[model samples]
Each structure stands twice: as C-alpha cells, then as structure tokens.
Target: MPKGIYNVPEAYNEPVLSYAPGTKEREQVAAAFKEMYNSTVDVPMYIGSEEIRTGKTRDINPPFDHKKSVGKYHEGDVSHVEKAIKSALDARTKWAALSWEHRASIFLKAAELIAGPYRAKINAATMIGQAKTVHQAEIDAACEFIDFLRFNVEFMTQIYAEQPVSSDGIWNRMEYRPLEGFIYAITPFNFTAIAGNLPASPAMMGNVVVWKPSASQMLSANVIMEVFKLAGLPDGVINMVQGNAAEISDTIFDHTDFAGVHYTGSTAVFNGIWGKIGQNINKYKTYPRIVGETGGKDFVLAHPSSIPAQVATALSRGAFEYQGQKCSAASRAYIPKSIWPEVKELLVKAVKSMKMGSTEDMSNFVSAVIHEGSFDKLASYIDAAKKASDAEIVVGGGYDKSKGWFIEPTVIETSNPKYDTMCTELFGPVLTVHVYDDTKWEETLKLVDETSPYALTGAIFSQDRYAIEQATKALENCAGNFYINDKPTGAVVGQQPFGGARASGTNDKAGSVLNLLRWVSPRTIKETFVPPTDYRYPFLG
Candidate 1:
C-alpha cells in the first residue's frame, strides 16, 4: 500500500576532509584516536536482536604497536555461524516485504551518520585497527563508504525504473524480487569501506545478510555495526559473526538456504569458496550468485615519452600508500630504459624520504603491515630478492618487528622480466621494476599483459598521444580499471566501478548497477487488455 512515488536525495560523493595541521578535523580525529587507543573495548557477535559473546575472546592489537591492546572481540564457533544464518533467514520475509523507499532511507541515514557524527571515530578505528594513515582512513572509512551508500540508493532506483515496453493492447512491468535465501558477505581488512560495503550493498537490495568481517578489522568493523544500528537497520537484517573463516564459510555454504556470497579477499580463498558452493549446488533452492573482487598484481607501465618525475610519483604513492596492501596497489612497474636512470633516482629519493611509524603522527607517510604474518611474508620476499642473481634491492631492504610489524618501502630491479616479484603478488610495501627497451613499447605491453594471472588494475603513463592510444588498446584486457597518466590505486565509487576478470574475479563492477543487479531475480509481467479468446482466429486467418 504505497501512496506515492518517492525519490531519494541527490547522491554525491562525500567531500574528503583534509586532516591537515591546525584543522578542526585533525583535532577531532586525534582526540578520538587517543581515546580509543587508551581504552579497551569488548566486542560481541550480533545475531537476531541479541549480542552473543561466547566468552572465547581474542585481543585486537594495532599493527603499528602489536603489544598494545585497543580492544578484544568475542570469537564464535560453527554454532554461532549457524545461528547467524538462521537469524538472516528468519528475518528475510519481513525485510524483503518492506518498502523499497524505506530501505533507501535507512542506507541514506547511515551515510549521513558516517559523514557527520561517526566520521572521526570510524577513521580513528581504521587507523588503530588496520594501520592506515589519516589520509588513507579519510578516503576509505569516510568518503568512499559514504559514496557507496548514497550512490547505491540512486543505482537501486535506476534498476527499479527499468521496465519492459507495453504494446497497445497490453500492459507490461517488471518486479525485482530479492533472492530466495540469504547472502553471505565476506570482507577483508585492507579497507574499512570495503568491509562495510560488502554487506551493506546486498542488504540495500532487501536481501538479508550474514556478514563475516576480517579479524584484523574488528575495531573499525564494530564502529560500522554501531552506525547501522543507529541508522535504524532492523534486527537480524545483517547478522555479523566473527571466528574461524573456514568454519563460518562451511556452515553457510552447506545450508540449503545459501543464496549468494559477496566476497573480497585472496584469490585462493575466493576460488576455494566457489568450489565449495559448486559442490553444494544441488542442495540449494536456487542457483546462487557469486560476486567477488579478489587479489591483484596491479601494474604501472610507462612509455618512453612519459615524464620521469610523474612516473616516479605514481610508483611512490601507488606502491607505498597504506603500505601497498590494496588489491589494486601497484606491485609491478615497467619503465622504459630511456628514462630508467631519472625515474630510479627520484623513486629512490622518495622511498628514502618517507617516515614509517605509528599513525598517531600525521607526518608519518608509512605504517606497519596488518600483522606479523604479513611482516614475515614481506621479509622473506625481500631476503629472497637480495639473493636472487637477476634481482637487486634498489633501496629499502630493511625490516624490523621488534616494536611493530614495520617493513621498509622496498624496491627490486630485475633483469628478468618474469622475476618472482614481478609476476607474483607481494601485497606489501614492495615494488618490482623491469627496465624494458624504449623501442620495445608494444612488446612491453604484451609482456605486461602476459606477466600476471590477475587483471584487476593497471596504469599507462605517456606524453605521446599515439603511444598512449597504442598502449591503451594493447592493454585493454589486462586491467578492469585502466588509468591514463595516473596510479592504479584510489578508485572512487561512482567514478570508477571496480572489479576484474580472469583470475582477478567475476568483474561484477561493485559500485554500479551491474553489481546491484546480481542481488535480485526479476519477474516479467504482461497483461493483455483483450482476453486471448480469439487467439486461434489469428492463426486461422
């Protein structure tokens, strides 16, 4: 019983606040960071209308200062995951039946809450829990997440507006119904925005969700749950559970009500879940939707005509920002031999200039990796590169975990184009470079395309129009989000729909209508004005 057509507020990207010196945002975030850092919080699993704290708890430690505990989150077992699934299923009917505008209003309110009251708190949590610099936290936990909520509302309305054309004697319409069962949302720790978005996107489409956030991100994830509760999201609409990933995934995938998964994690993990879903396909009531944005060995390829200074800046920022943990972070670079000396000099200087420490100091451009495991992995890679005959550590081959999991921004120059660092994903503050001959621009593009199993993101820098065009065409299939004269990271929500094909992911393009379409099953309705009583007469004539 809807009374009138409703239009959501005009959606726009939330303005990113510069937490610069002497600014109000700077003071607010610093205060919040200090308060959260000094306090210890206990987080529990959310199922239905209850907060279930299974006394089994794990401490939430900051990567930049591992010995200090900012909080602890209650860990769940298989039973807790099962309860979360049941909660989502039990709540699905009422949630899906709610008016679409109501759903839109809830998310829009969440956006405002994030933009206004919760901005500093969420950003500080990201800084403490995930080790992101203030700028990184601002762009991610604040602006990008706000954009995802507001723009998704607009995208939903657009999807609802799409209808079939009616003939003169008939009427036609389309009804987009939520999937038959619940959604399983698995998010990563690299970006707090992604952690919020993976579940919020599906829930915005009226599908109930069972979300499992990464353990390393519990602090910021708890803030997101708070925002959702304040924004008036109903109980059990999105049940959040944290524990063993395998146990949670197994419990969800084996259920007959398993409808779909929205995942952002390692390529290996995504593939593993896809296999599990395939094995359980026979048990499901409907074919499940699988959407994921996985790992990336993203690249930056420079033409001989490219400016050395610009290319150097791109690599410095793209490879070291957030310690290069981003899925789209530039892990590999192909620089022309003509400009190699200048680019190398500038890049080395930039890396040497960055100060790495805790995010409390706004001047620190780099911070620790997420955990000890990442620190060890990056150290092993740096050690291996040091001994490799064809590779040399150009700069920053040092690491120290005595205080925190800090790895220096390292660069490896390899004579071999297929060196392990160039082809593999390091997912740390490491960049590998291959100096190709300037005349071999086309050949280098081919090499770049063929180098990685991933096709998530890549950037081409060039001053020559013809070279740019040629590189663009040659590298089309290698990057889902291709950038011209820029770094591969920092993709905005509405401006660049992000995802990939091949080993990267399903390329569903999260942030656009294409992604939202995956959550609904449309039914076409056509009513004839004249009954088909004379149907046989037309055939006879």
Candidate 2:
C-alpha cells in the first residue's frame, strides 16, 4: 500500500505518429493489420468474471470491403443485460470503496500499455475495424485515448485535493465518493478513443460501468477490453454487452440500478434515451447522471481579410476527416462575398485532390463511410443538390457503392443561407458554402448563430483583430468549442476539454475534472478539536 498523499506526473497530450514511409511504427501496424485481417476473431459478451458466448452471433466486416468477413460477435438478449447490470451492482460496493490511487493506477497503466506494447495492435484494429486511415488511427485509437487515461488520473487528484477551508477549532476534509451505482456508456463507432474513454473514465473514478459499443465498432472495442484486463482492472468492474439495442437498452434503462449514461451519437437517439430515463427515474435508486455529446451543424466563418488558402485547408481537413462523421465536422461555411471566388477555387482544388480508398493504403486520405445506410443518405443529399436551382456542386459529388461505401469529398455552394445543407447536420463528406456581404459581418455572425439548432463547434478566420473580437462575442453561444484560425475538429483531450451547449450536450466538458466530478458526490467532513459538552447557544446562556 502507498503511504503518502501523492501527485500524479505532469500530463501532456500524446504526440501523433506520422507513420511515414519506411518507419518501424508503420511496419508494425501494417503487420498487425495484415495478421488480424487474415484471421477471424470471435468476441464474447462480458458478464462478471465470466465470458458468456451466446450461440447467436452477427458477422462483421470492414466498411472498405464488406464482402470480406473479419469476425463475429456474440449477441445476447434481455436476460444477459439483466445479468450484466446485476453483476455491476454486486461489484459496486467493492469498487467504490477502493482507494482512489489504486483506481487511478489501473488506468495509468492502461495508458502506458497503449503508448507502448499495445499501440500497434490497437491502432491496427481501429484502422481495419472502423475504416480509419493510419494517421487517423494514430491520433484517435493510440494518442487521444492515451491522453484521456493519463489526464484522467491527474484530474482525479485535482478533484480529491479540493477541500473546504477549516476554521481554527476544526479540521475539515473532503471525501469524493463514487456514485452508488454503475454508469451506462453508449459509445459511437467513429473513434476508438471515445469508445474506450466513455467507460474507463468513470471506472477510473471508482464507478463500475455497463458499456455498450456501437455494433459497428466491436473489433476495436474488444481490443480495449483486452487492454483493461492486462492493466489488472478487476473483473465485474466494467461489463461489455452486445445484442438488440432496443432490447438491451430497455432492459438496462428499466433497471433500478441504472446510475448514469455517457453517450455520443445522434440527437434523436439521445433524446429517446433521455425520455426513457425520465420515465423510469422514479424506479432508479438515485437520479441518474446524463452526459452526452450529440449532433452538430458545425460551421467555419471566414472574414474577407483572411487568407483563402488557410480557409481552404481548414475546410478540406475539417469537413472530410473520418469521412466527416465527427460531431465537430465543419459541415457549413460562411464566406464573405469579397473572397468567395478565390476561396471557392482553392477549396475545390483541395477537395478534388483528396484520395478515397481502403485504409491499408498509406497514401489514401479518406476511406469508406461506416455503412451502406450512411452512403445512401449522403448520395441522396448529393442528388438533391444537383436538382435544386439554388445549390450547385462545384468539385466532387460522386458516389460508388460497387466495392466500398465511398462518397467523394463534395462541396455544395448554396445561395440560400437557410438551405437544408447549411442548417442541417448531414454528417458526411458534404460541405455547404453560403456567401454573405463582407460589410455585414455582424449580421452574418447572427445568421450563422441562429441558423443551426445545434451549438457544438465553429471556427472563424480573420486578420483584423476587431472582426475577430466581434465574431467571437457574437457567436459565443453558438459553439461549445470555438476556434480561431484553426479547424473545428480534432480537439485535444486536456487542452480543449470538449463539449457544447444547448442541443449539443450538457457541456460537462469531457476530458476535464468537471466531467469526473459528475461520477462522484463530495462530502465535507467537519471535525471539532474541542467538543462542545453543552448543546446550547449564546442566546440560551
């Protein structure tokens, strides 16, 4: 047992690996991907210390090549969900009573494993499983997740160090107690980091969890479970389940032990989850905590004084990375009319130059979208833009589903600011451009602010300080993570502390102490050095 109150090492963002040509890291990840691709994997749902394999299973494959089957994951029914929840609740007392430092060390060890021995394997799984490029996997599965684990340990100390001030006669201590029950982590498929962080972050704070990964993300999610085991995380502390989402969620949410939900996905699904929780709130032991990051019509605003080249770069990268599935993807752009021609020319050139293909190819910048449904949805939007008089496809608007679910990085120039593409969250490789008069900068800011029902992320580029200040203030409530001269996507773990307001989320600021605070209830311990023998006030005397 460690004796003294200790401080965690200084936290820093994990550096992204370039995986350039002839690099050892590149070779390692490639080898891992090849081995995993050639072999079939079987994943089992975890309940307590047991690995329960239901005979019912579903086939999974890479989005880039759906014909190639890579693995199968067991699917359970409502009974398994009930068993998992019961196991979690049964383990909650032991988990919550564990010392905070012991809990923190488990995740810190997991981070080191990710940064070292498990790096290539985890990145390989993400690239093959989620259709992420090597660079994308490096940043997300390898780096960002590592940052979350390491920084979350440091954040635990911060939460613990916060104590109430004591007077001369008393010694006051603050104890941060983990929630009485487990958390339900509803994770998305776009990023392996998020799938890992959603469950483990709360687990690090001593709260057990029932984690449900996106059915599309099972391959990498299994790898995360493997790493946690190697890190010596006790069994029953975190349970993984896969099955009919409706059956599973209904079973879990209806349980009285359900404590909280950590979700990242569509607004509609999140709203449904919220409604379910509300309807069952009276049955739960405690008022469950809800922390979610949902849909966004994120935008990029460029002033006339800004460089067209820089604006073009941000749009190209922001709107298309991970095939624009990010919650912070720049789906809309507000450009000044004075610079529209130049910006359009540069943006079109960049979009046309991007390569879309399988992630196995190192040079390919974009890969196939996650599934056929997303591809069909994007193709419909592109066809609609082609027919509409106000909307024009400037660069690329092609879709081919013969081999993989591929949609070209498309740029839609719309005359109407209120166009569906401008105001809606298409969540694909579609960027809508709406040009406004440069003189009415303030009005443009307001239009940008008021256009979207979602306030997740937005960026502004301007050479003039006054315009920067004006736009920043005007669009303050419009974005949770605002950027100046940078793309709205790729928020670092500790530095950005990302979340949004309004429909975007509760703005709990994941990857920060504020987020960890959600899992713990603070109790102030007041100790009196001198006991008052008489229970009487001065007025009584």
Candidate 3:
C-alpha cells in the first residue's frame, strides 16, 4: 500500500461529439466504418493469457446490411465457461490484492484511450455491430462508456474514503473489499457502453469478472476487450466467453466461487438467473450479489397544459432514437384530448420525415433494429395494430427486411389504454399513444402507473407546475427515472444515475456511487490505542 493517500481526477461526463456532415469526426468515423465493414476480423474467446478460438464460429453482419459480412466470432462451449470461471478465480487473488489506486489508474487509462485514440473506431464498431446511428454510437459507445469508466473511478475513491467515525480512544476505518470469488457479467447488445460497464465496474472495485457479451454485440465487444488489453488490463481479470447463454449461465451459476453477477438484459433472463442462483444457493462460498437492469415499458404522459410541439419532439426523439431499443425508450404514451390533435400532427410529420437506412448515411435519423428477431417482433406488432380495432397506425408503419432489418419509425394511436401495444414493451421504433380526457389527469396518471410491469423510465409533459407536481407524486413508482419536460431516453452518467425497480431492475442507479457500492463488501475496523487487561467492559463491571 502507498504511504500517502491519493485522489482521483474529478469525473465529468464526456462531451458528446456531433458528427455533422462537414465535421472532421464525421469524415474520420465514416472512413473507419468503411474499413471495418469491408474487412473480415476473427474474434476469439479470451481466457487467461490465451485466445481460445473454437472451430464453431458465427459470422457478424450489420443489421442494416445483413447480407454483407463484417467479421466472425468463435463460439465457446461449457468447458470454456468453466475455464473462464477458473481463470477469474485464479486471477482474483492478485487482482483484488493490488493497490486500489493502480486499479483506478487502469480504468482511467481506458477512459482516456477511448476518448483519444479509439473514439472513432469504437463508434464505428458500435454503428456497424449494433446498428446505431453516428450520434447514438457517439453517445453510447464513445462518450457514455468513457464517462462510466472515469465516473466509476471517482465513485470508487469516494467509497474508499467513506471512513467510519472514530471514537476518542479507538481509531475506526472502513475497507471496501471486492466480493469474495468471481463476478459474472452478462452484457447486452444495445449499448457498447453497457457492454463495457457490466464487467468493468466490478473489476474496477477489485473483483475478477467472467464476461459473456451478447452474441449480436460481438463485433464491438471484441473491440472493448482489445481496448482493455491495450490499457494493460490483466488477461484473466476479465475473461470473455461467447456461446449459448443458457450453457454459459448454468456453468457460472453452479460454480462454488461464483460471487456475483452484473447484468443488463431481458427481465425473463434475469429472473431465470435469479431462480437458478436460488436453487443453487447452498453451493456458493458466499451469497452472490445480483445486479441487473432489465426490460422496460417506459412511458410518456402529456398534460393538457403541455406544449404540443414539445410533447411531439419528446415522443419523436424519446421513442424513435436507436429504433426505440433502449430500456428507457418511450414505448407508450398517454396524451390528453386537448393537445392530441396538435401533438398528433407534429409527431406524425416528424416521424414521416425521419430518414431510415444505414448508419453510414449521417443524415438518416433511424437505422435497422438489432437483428431479425427484433425486426420480426416489431413487424408482428405493427401487423397486429393494423388489424386491431382498438389501435390504428397513425403515420409510419412500413417495415422491410429485404436488404436490411429496417422498420420505419412508427406511431400507433390506441383507443384503449389497456391495448397490447400500449401496455407491452415493443422494443422497436413503435410508440403507442392513448388520448385521455383532459379533466382526468389524476385518473390517467393512475392508468399509466398500472399499465405496465416495468418501471425503468418515463416522462411527463406539462407546462403547469401543479400538474407536473401531481404527476411526479402520483406516478412516482411507475418510473425510476422520470423526466419533467425532456425525454427519458438519454440518462447522462453523473447528472442522472439510471436504473429502475419493479420488473425493470434493482434500481441500483448506475453512473453513481450506488452502483459501485453493490460490487464491494465493506468492512468496518475499530482499533483501541491501548489494550485493557480486564476482559469485561465498564458496563459489564
């Protein structure tokens, strides 16, 4: 341990780069995307110091250009998962024993590497791999990821500095230790930032991680591992495995050394993992920590006093950005009858004008959904809405998977608030709006709250302070992160620590100290300056 205490640099959100048509970032990212798209890179499982390339491989194709191949990733089996767990446990001793500052420094270096050298490449990788537009990629893959690292380092320092209040004769201190054994990180395909964070956060807190990135996100996930290696992250500290989710999860869940899991994915998968852990509760050396941010049927409720344009813009951006794949994306909306006409007109025009195609086209606001399954799901929902008596496709409802898994930014106007499209989480560019009576604001609030099982994110559009206050109070538990005038989709790192409760997640706000605290097991130490010969305390005497 170092003699002197150290302070980490102040953490700030990484500035989002706007890849304007004439900008240098635009040109650079486009070039990088072109090169990466044309090239064929092979990704292998990273276990300990070795790169294990299983013969079984899956080709990576961009969702927008499904026929074109960008790369291929090797598939690992159950044995590989076992190897990954073993490697993590083996590395945990040395990794967890290292000075906290050194651990902090590594991730800090990763943030800088991402911010400076690898910004465009990572953005390009996310764009190609996950079908994100340049702006979305810039925010999620580049800025938000950098922010998670830097902010997490700062949060770690804060956690360590939180010492116990010492008494006069006794010196008290607190030690934030990593969880015993190893951490399993299951990351999603939507955000490369989340893919990096789900593993990196635990590791930063001195835990070893066995990471399983989403199969569809392998292209960017590969780049993340490369960045970690370049930043001098030890090999076994974060072992990457790719294979069947069930096989890998079962192997991890059964391990005696399985310490915890940091996950971001479907609620069903999380529930299954939770159940598996419960069934194998007695097999673990320690009780495993379960941290996850799952599915969301996020909402947008408009008050009668709200501006139509503002509400329209909020719905357009909040619901349609990134093809509405975000857990916090506005999937359902409750609009008052007063502003429904104007809001409908503005929203329709906006959705109609949104250009949809490849991420390569900077002007295009919308891109393909992540994969064919997601595309099919969205298509089926659209088809269902078209046929349903309670719902009608308002403006954009066309979907074509011929050249790409492209779905037009769609809006569904529903007569019934309880309609399937309004209640269900259609994780696509589909926003279902239900117009309610202007006088029944409180009733609508109740309806919004009770509509969905998720409470991830929601937004309330109201110029009236009283209505805003009422909505805030009445719809409190409906959303973990609630927006007053803005869209609920973009939750910045430090500014708005994101996560939700209910079926959505544990509500452990990521991008804050709250999330970091989950990874550590704190111990309080109290030492007396002088030892007493008597065994009994003064009170006992």
Candidate 4:
C-alpha cells in the first residue's frame, strides 16, 4: 500500500425509506418479510472461523406472532465462551496489525451491503424479530445501522489521521491503539442498528470483540453476522454468542484477558457488570474500558404556548412507534394546564386511532412487546393505574396474550406528578401524562428533571422562545439527548449522537467520534531530526 496522507469521503446520514404505498423498497421488503416469516432458520454460534452448534437450543419466535417460528438458535455454554475468548485473543495480533485503511475498507463494504442488497433482508428480520414496524425497521436496521458502518469507518480514519503538535527539532505523531485485550459488546433487543454498531465500531478500531446480543434479537443479529462475513471481515474478529446472560457474562468478565465492555441494556445489569469488574480490577493486565448505554425514562414537556396538534403528534409517534420499547421513547410527559385539555383530546384520538398488530402489515404502527415478561410487567402497570384513583386510562388499556404478547398502546393521565408509572421505566407502549399549572413552568420543569433517575432523552415544544430557552437551560443536566420542538426518540447517528448522563449511561454519545475514542487508547511517538551532542540544556549554560 502506498504510504501517503489520506482522507475519508464526506459522511452523510442515510435517508430513511417511508415504505409507503407502491414503493419498490416496500415490495422487496414485503417479499422478504413473507419469505422470512414462512422460513425457520437455524442459528449457530460463530467462533473464530467455525460455526459451532451446541446440542442445547431454543426456538426464536416473533414477538408479534409467537406461534410462528422464525428460527432456532443454538445456545452455547461456558466452554464455548472460553473458546470464543481464545479465538479472539488468537486473532487480535494479526487483525490489529493490519493497516487502518484496510480496516476502513471492510466496514465501508459492509455499509454498502446493508444499504443495497441486505437492506430488505435485514429490515425484514428486524420487523419479524423485534416486532418493529416497517418505518421503525427502515430507520433502525436499514438507515441507522448502515450509517454506523459507513460513518464509523470515516470516524476511524479521522482518528488515525490525528497527530500531535511537533516542536522545533522533532516530529510528533499520535497513534490510536485499540485496547490491549479483547472488547466485550453486550447489546440490547430494541435496535438492530445498535446491536451491530456496538461490536463493529470497536472492531473497526483494530480490536477483537466478543459480542453477546440479546436472546430476543437473534434473528436480526444472525443477519448482521452474515453481512459482516460478506464484507470480508476476518474470522474471529467478532465472535457472536447467544445464551444465558448471567453465565456468559460471568464467564467473560472472569477472564484475565478482558479489556473492556461496550454495553447497551438495563441499569441493574450495567451496575452488576461494573461491580464485577471492580471486584476483579486487580486481576487484569490493563485497565478495562467500560462504555455503556442503558435505560431511559425519556420525556416530552409541552408548554402552554405550544401547538396542540404538533405536541400530540410528537407523543404519538415518539411513544407508540415500536410499542415504546426504545430507551429513548417518551414514556412520560409533562403538559401545562393551559393546553392540557386540547392536548389530551388530540393525543387520545391519535393513540386510539393507531393500529396495533403484526409488523408483517405496514399499516400497524404498534406491535407486541419483546416477550411475556415485558408484557406481564406492562400489564401489571396498566392494571395498577386502572385501580388507583390518581391515574386514569384516557385512551387505551387493553391487553391480550392468548394470541401473542400484545398490549394496546395505553396512555395514563395521572394527577400525581410523582406517580410510580410516571417515574418508572415501563419499556412498553405506556405514556403517563402529568399536567401542571401554566404559571408553574419552572417548577414543572424541575419536576420533570427530578422525577426520574434517568437523564437519557427529553423534549420541549414551545412557540415562545423565552420558554424554550428556559426549558433548555433548566433541563440541561437532565437529558443527554435533548430535543427542541421535536420528539425525544429517533436520534439519528451523526446529527444527534445518542446517550445520556447519570442512570442513563456513561454519556459516551454513541455514533459519534466520542464513542469510537472509548474503544482506543492513544500513544504518542516523537521522531527527532537533530540531537544535542552533549546532554546539556541551554538554561544550564
């Protein structure tokens, strides 16, 4: 390869396909959906160059229709985890030693695959697997994941191009080295894009990754592996495993070679991982980097001066889309009294009109939660709201699990600002609205800020610039991803780098250069053109 200064192509956000009527992409995706839905795939754990299949297995079913078998994934145990670790270590040296441009090329090709041929397949898989509708899958699996791959490659090259300032007689250079040991990527079930990006971003920075995707996300996760393989990624660069979280995490965290963990899941699990790493701090050769994105009780606050239609639409799309499973989904809303009546009427109408069913049909905006546990938890919350005097179901509060884990998109209007439903992360299609006095905007803003432990995402809709400015400043520390006159959900990769502070996450801001920086440890190199003959300083003379 020629050694010369290089620059990556200008990164651009991938356009989301509406998948509207009579569109070619819609037809292709619909066809793929039908094919995938009718088929039952067998998924195996990918370790090194081998696809290992364990005797122990479990069926993978779509959340929308549990009776329909999408696939079956082989479950690996501790021994398999060991092999995965060994495989990663064995491959790290050669993989990391390769030139940065080569690494960039592989992921760039992967992005193209996602953007073109695999787009329909991946989106279909996401729709079937995660119960996401066409629009959600289009934005998530197709656009966001593709953005991650292409932009991450560009970001990687940007990182490699950065050099230190050189002094009079010396040339200074900086190298962004991957972590000494392997990285552990623990992804969640919500976003297929996040699942792929978590591991791929680190691996692109010359690191080996042991990725453990959520059990619920196996269908789309397997597709991601296939796409990576097609991109000519080397074997053992990213080892895919699906199994018991506790067993696998314990095994991975216990290993001496463990360098870091890139996690996106719950707060409890994140805390447990941190505690375990702390307990084993003395055992590792180097300090392990922990980059995580966890839970969010994301909110939307509409001011008295805001337009009711726009505010209602924001809540409808932000909360009900994908059944409010996204961490950044608006589960809580703080509306002022002046527009409360109109906002409620419009919101109730919109929510009532939303179609909740299988993702196979593009008409349905809402679908089933991930599984029974989630369904049960959400159902319990809805029941509690119904029984309690402080909370009232304004639009929807229905659930039916006999067919599939389906819960109607429920909105609870609560008088108690500090109600359990208002603060807790339901992680379902449930939005609790807390109405406050128009004069108490500042106080209500404080209530929104202090109500939840999470600071992931929050939005303020206002026609008044002064009110918007105040909300923006007051809620500055409350949400990492804050939106103005927009919903809290749908944070595009480059434009709005996602993550939050406090209980939300480490605020590493995924999809940005900041997140990529966490995967690397920088080292400086200096080359001297002239040497002092006598090791004496001019100050001494």
lDDT per residue (tens digit) for residues 1-541 in model 4: 4697667777788888878899999999999999999989999999999998997899999987898787899999999999999999999999999888788889888999999999999999999999999999999999999899888888887777778788899999998889999999999999999999999999999999999999999999999999999999999999998888899999988888899999999999999999999999998889999998999999999989999999999999898888999999999999988898998899988988888889988898888999999999999999999999999999899999987899999899999999999989989999999999888888998898899999999999999999999999999998999999999998888889999999988999998999999999999889999877898889998
Model 2 scores a C-alpha lDDT of 0.91
Worst 10 residues of 3 by lDDT: 1-10
The lDDT of model 1 is: 0.95
TM-score of each: 0.99, 0.98, 0.99, 0.99
Question: 110-221, model 1: which lDDT tens digit per residue?
Answer: 9999999999999999999999999999999999999999999999999999999998999999999999999999999999999999999899999999999999999999
The C-alpha RMSD in Å for every predicted model, in order, reads: 0.9, 1.1, 1.1, 1.0
Model 3 stretches with alpha carbons more than 4 Å out: 536-541
The true-versus-predicted C-alpha distance at residue 84 of model 4, in Å, is: 0.4
C-alpha positional error of residue 22 in candidate 2 after TM-score superposition, expressed in Å = 0.8
lDDT of 3 by residue, 107-155 (tens): 9999999998899899999999999999999999999999999999999
lDDT, candidates in the order shown: 0.95, 0.91, 0.93, 0.92
Candidate 2 per-residue lDDT over residues 459-511, each given as its tens digit:
99999999999999999998999999999998999999999988898888888
After superposition, the stretches of candidate 1 with alpha carbons farther than 4 Å from their true spots are: none
